[model samples]
Target: MKGEKMMKQNQQDTPLYTGLTRFSQQHPISFHVPGHKNGAIFPELAKNTFRDILSIDMTELTGLDDLHAPTGIIAEAEQLAAAFFAADRTFFLVGGSTVGNLAMILAVCSAGERIIVQRNSHKSIINGLELCGAVPVFIAPEYDQTAGRYTQPSLDTLRQALRKYPDAKGIVLTYPDYFGKAYKMEQMIQLAHTYDIPVLVDEAHGVHFSLGNPFPPSAARLGADMVVQSAHKMAPAMTMTAYLHITGKLVAKDRVAHYLQMLQSSSPSYPLMASLDIARSFLATFSQQDKDKVMTSVKQVRACFGQGNAWQLLPATKLDDPLKLTLHIKQGYTGFQVARYFEQSGIYPELATNTQVLFIHGLQPFGELEQLDNAIKHVNDQLKFVEKHATIEVVNQFPQKLDTLAIPYQQMHLHDIVHVSLHQAVDKVAAEAITPYPPGIPLIMMGERVTVEHIKQIKHLIKQGATFQHPDIINSICIFADE
Candidate 1:
């Protein structure tokens, strides 16, 4: 009993967590940034509902330390995170991977610099490009027709992009794409380093990759100069929590710190930061038994679907994150169709596309597996053995890559922007990004010309029930008015 107690006590020795625990115990009086004053406004909050969580929803007090200039407990917590992830430095992100991408881009690539970027990069990466006025040199990733998603950029693609944009500042890539398709980042990073260009990886879906070897290698451990992981996406962390890791010396540490100060919230959420620390502490020591339990649940659910099932998982041919389930719907059925059925059966998926539905799993107990098993059975019961093949494969509507440095619209006035329909907007420079939400990559970036191919892809996605953030502009896009 004593030994068990001692072991548990030792595990709770994290820096920021320790400080937060001590601070919360003090029961400091309300007098800070949050108007709620630690749930004072909500009586239910004080009635043991979110007492503990709300208690720690604190601000940068004396010993608590500010997130922007972490010199105390926050610094220690970040240091622990760095050691856990094998990074030189780690920064907690309250605005999620979006802010991390912004900070990373701003840190490594200066304004007016050319940076090679994946065509399927998250919209936040594009926002960083817009903010920094960086010229993006696009590298087309390998597209998977079976999975109906974009996979990793091949070594050849990276090599070609590097050769073409030899003077580019660095490369920004999306690792383990939104559907949990793992990329060969180590080889790609090695190749980029050969050209003396740093590699920034948006590993938003791979925070658990480092927790268990059952998953692919984390980009943070694969020699990427900068790596951003949305801890909330897969780990036991709160939503909007993430980590930015600086793994190599190519990017100056001070520059990243500076950008983080400029980009992150001045009044950062202590709850979010504490959640990151707690999540990291939990993942650092995640038991093998827990991993086996998750694996067992996954296998049990997989077993529910037998051979000849209308919906089978995407083939795990290459290195992929086992925890992410991308189920391919066959025989003229769309992913939206399967996803709707799943929802009807009380099963919710992470994301769905025209041909596939994505389900993300984490270390926490999967209480919904039995419900999913029944859902699968229910779905299979309604399946008709149609003789026709599925015609849901999207047409190759990916537009040609920009041959020259991307023209920046950073200096352009917003009043000069004009909204035009897809057909009329062809050949016109886009004034804003038009992206589909499941995988938030911009189809047409600012200052880039809209094409018929882009229009076709947008129409196809909408036809398949895919929604957009700017629905008003889905049929049309905001573009720069004629000069």
Candidate 2:
């Protein structure tokens, strides 16, 4: 017990942050890169705001330790993170979870190899598969009628895929779907392992799951071979900061490290690395009292919304993360309109869809309940007076339980592409991915055969003022030319 207490206390130390601070205090002369010379030559307008941060925006210096080959402070910080997250090894990602996803996929699967992928996975995961020239067998997620969104694929679907493709190189998944809904992740992982298939998870929004209860269990904890998390998403870290953890040795650690060094920038930001260290300390030091306070504040916010009839909170299940609050707009009002009203009141939600808006609460207690209550009351009253539109009835986007690309990624570049109207896109193969922002899932993935349902969903989303990552493809989309 004493040894455990001492180890817990040791997590408080921030080696990388301390090293950067010590280096900055020396008033070191800059005979190096970054022409700004530590904020000295920075633009006058933003100099004041960026002064302190720029001071530590260093490159791979003598004391700073290289990211590709961490030997000192960075190695220590990553070691601490591995211990905290209960992984065999951990790597600090300077390029967000995107790079981590790419590295893991590239490391595990090669050209022409089969990989089982979640259909509703973020674009990054798809992009990774394309980059590595792997053939993806997509398993569509099961739509949660209660939450009105897609969660992880059902275990039966996974079992069928495993039995059909026993030679699959790996399985890629997203836990706690964009709406913070989690399914039987552990069971899924166990099932994959029985086939000797490694599970690589894009757990970008689940960094805080390490805090324990009130949050779903992290993929790393559930025995995923490789788990990548975006620290900046939920933790108080700068953008692009992330962590990559390797649990058991289903995938080679050296190969992952090799791909990361190739994919990530040669010069990593010291400030970003330092923020990762601080974020880790933040989670390691979070107490039971802190969790209780955060939960209380979350309940209070829910109560505030509950008092009104304008919004209906998505019912929480046992596996749902308490930090995510999804509210369905009542009375045919689009969530985009409700989101705009909230923005006018200076309250910006995480994202809004045709039927619901999602709010992401931090680990700390919400201190502005009064302001939030006022915003809720104002939105409710104002929405009553606002114009109403036909609500887009939610439907299953990916109807098929299992699918594969009509045209493989390697063969895509050889095809000629042409643009066609949304109505004419049906029965045509897509040349590019058309994705919805916020959640970042591709509605029509590259090499996928576009269907009438895809056009219908896109049209309704457009009518409701939803934003798309490929906004240029709204009226016309690029499709593979008929051979």
- Give the per-residue lDDT of model 1 (tens digit) for 1-483: 997666445445577877988987887888776776776665763557776677778888899999988999999888878877879999999999999999999988887789998877899998998888887887777777766666666788778878888898989998888877886678888888888899998999989888746788888888999999999998888999999999767899899889888887799988899888898889877788988888887676555544426677776544677778778777577777778877888888888877778887667556765677788876766555433334446545444443332346445564387778888888777777887786787777777777777777777777778878786865567877863
Q: Give the whole-model CA lDDT for all candidates, comma-separated.
A: 0.79, 0.89
Q: What is the lDDT of candidate 2?
A: 0.89
Give residue 284's lDDT in candidate 1 (0 to 100): 77
Q: Using lDDT as the measure, which candidate wins?
A: 2
Per-candidate RMSD, Å: 3.5, 1.2
| Best candidate, TM-score | 2
- Candidate 1 residue runs with Cα over 4 Å from true position: 1-12, 43-49, 305-309, 381-392, 399-406, 410-415
Cα error, candidate 1, residue 402 (Å): 6.1
Candidate 2 lDDT, 174-273, residue by residue in tens: 9877778876789889999988899999989889888888688888888999999999998999999999999997999999999999998898888999
